[model samples]
Target: MQKMKMIKRGAASVAIALLLLPMADTAHATIVKHYGVDWSKFQGNNGKWGYARDDFSISQIGGYYNGYFIDQSTYGTQVSNTIALNRRAHTYIYAQFSGRNQADQMLDYYLPKVQTPKGSIVMLDVESGNPDTDSVLYALKRVKDAGYTAVLYGYRSFLTSHLDLASIAKQYPLALAEYKDYKVTAEPDYNYFPSFDNVQLFQFTSTYVAGGLDGDVDFTGITENGYKGGNAQAPTTSTPATTTGKQLHQDTHNYTVKSGDTLSAIASRYGMTVNALVTLNGIKNANLIYPGQVLRVADSGQGSTVSQKATTTTTTSTYTIRYGDTLSGIASRYGTSISALASLNGISNPNWIYPGQLLKLSGGSSARTYTVRSGDTLSGIASRLGTSWTALKAKNGLANANLIYPGQTLYY
Candidate 1:
């Protein structure tokens, strides 16, 4: 994080004044964009690490400062909480411009402590200390070499003045910090955007929400992309397709559980629900699975018992909404759409879902017209609608398959 300097008002005074300001009109409220916050030890663990509406959260795990390693006190808690809340959790290392070996030392100490899954982005904060281009590059290279995507973060002036911004931008994504005012800015002003092509995130305000949480808007899909989950692998099982007479049979097989295997991942791999998997294996707790334990992935001969039950059961499958549950997240998990979920559940506002509410998992109406939602791709919608993407594109007269917006209705 860049050092924040105040002029006339103190921290408390500024927060109070901001809170007292009139809220924006409901009609003119900024469209919900990809918002995120970066946290350090200063934020503490009294629970306010980030906004509830945040799309992602980045926490400082540990870093090299002056000649020693400084570990953040709230790194583990923040990372775990972010993951538990189903938001993308990223980590950063504040590196000094001492030498190339400083990057190595920092990674050695912090990599073991990082809780995010492999291939997630790990930012290298290089705003403080004397700027050295070689040192920065060394740190970024080390971060990528350790099997995680690397992003460079620094103030606009610090990055432009002392570093090769063009060359660095070509090599790695940049998170530039250039605030306009002390007040919370909902969006970044592109007029003041730094000269770069691969800029992923812009730190628009240092006081996004009261207690010094920096507000960031992801211009590109850097934070939105990648596997943002626990360090778990799905079970390895072979689905052998054979023909007995005229009917094709998918042979059921067993999978020996490995370390870091999750029941959800295993179930998803074998096309079985978590509950069905648990019932089939007679497991007490879904979370408790050990290495080398053999579990049935599918049923043989007459097909899976879950599949048979699905065909015979007339009751509508449902899910109870939990804390931090979002319509978009739930839809993706169940292979449905936000519009479908909203229409089926009598929800006028997709953003507003309460905990403990029962939501139907299946039996949404097959309407001829479909409204697009955020994160909806053409192929995904086509899949849900039981049609080819090309056919949908031609029928809807869409020029670009990649270009679609929320609330845009398409007729099939």
Candidate 2:
């Protein structure tokens, strides 16, 4: 927004002012995040992996991956008849269905002929095989009636006590599982599975690029609609029990541990990494597993959780800072603390808060100011605007978290 003019002629005065701003762009994307071996037998003969189309290249590095389903045991003696043929990553397959005729030969003989390409996404790194719960909801309704889109990958208490990725993402698409220095977006939404209304991806770096078949290949981000980008709609009022509600599409499977259970209550029901369900079940202590054991789950997602959206009438308020909000990370949201919010809205050096300042957040929600355009920052706008940089510096009152500049404005 831009407009400013003031004049004084013969008699006296005239003024015109209207400046509303926020837009800074810079971030192009094309990710690739695959994990080691089990690439349906990945093996560049030696560059290391298991077997895709050989001579490695994986689209020369830009497509992106996040798999790691080691030993989906070939579903039927062996698989992977085609893969990486022309290099294009968007995968997230991770298998393990066991019985119900191997989940009906992976939903009617190998998911409607595996040929991926056309906004691709297929899932079920189900942190445990052995059907029950109606053969994993009929193999996720046969990969969503063979059109595609279904993810339940586990880790974090075995994906919330069995499975409920926002109620199976309201019917498929919830992929979240990573290793090392952890981060399925720092879990906590009942262990993990907050909303993008069914979360699409967040495998986060698994390692082992270049293709094979489709075993270890999660790494993905490419978002336009769904993914861990979070906060899409919903939130109009209360949401900070750390957020995680809404998603009950028929109470997602209701089983309680039997047959001896406990790879830690099946990896905490469903948040998983009993060593990736003991490497998709071939086993080696997740404390020697137990019960009817059964396990499998994967997510090596690399990147892709895009966002720009925010305006249903934008609602999470508590703001008041006007005088042209200092152009950097702006001010502390509403609860106050950009140095007590520029000293309770007065203005000093906490980057001199401006733009009609005033914040308040005990319960009267109203703190909206999101300007930082031109390809925003604060860690890719807290990974594409879902949010996080200590909650955008405690809602924007940064004393210095790596200070910011170039036209700023923030408030969650």
Query: Which of the numbered candidates is closest to the native, going by highest lDDT?
Result: 1
Badly placed stretches (over 4 Å) of model 1 are: 1-33, 46-52, 228-412
Can you write out model 1's per-residue Cα lDDT over 125-174, one digit (the tens) per residue?
Answer: 98888766777777788878876778999887887887887777778888
- Residue lDDT tens for model 2, 1-412: 0111212222221111100122112132323233322233233211233344221111110111122223333221111111212122222344555445666655554454343332234456566543244566677777666554545555534666654445555555555544433322211121222223433344433432332221232223322112122222222222211011111101122122223244543433344434334433456555554333233422211011122443222333455544323322232323234454445445556544445555532344344555454445577667666778887765554544454432344555
What's the C-alpha lDDT at position 57 in model 2?
18
The estimated TM-scores of all candidates read 0.48, 0.19
Candidate 2 accuracy as TM-score: 0.19
In TM-score terms, which candidate is top?
1
Least well predicted 10-residue stretch by lDDT in candidate 1: 237-246
Whole-model lDDT per candidate: 0.61, 0.37
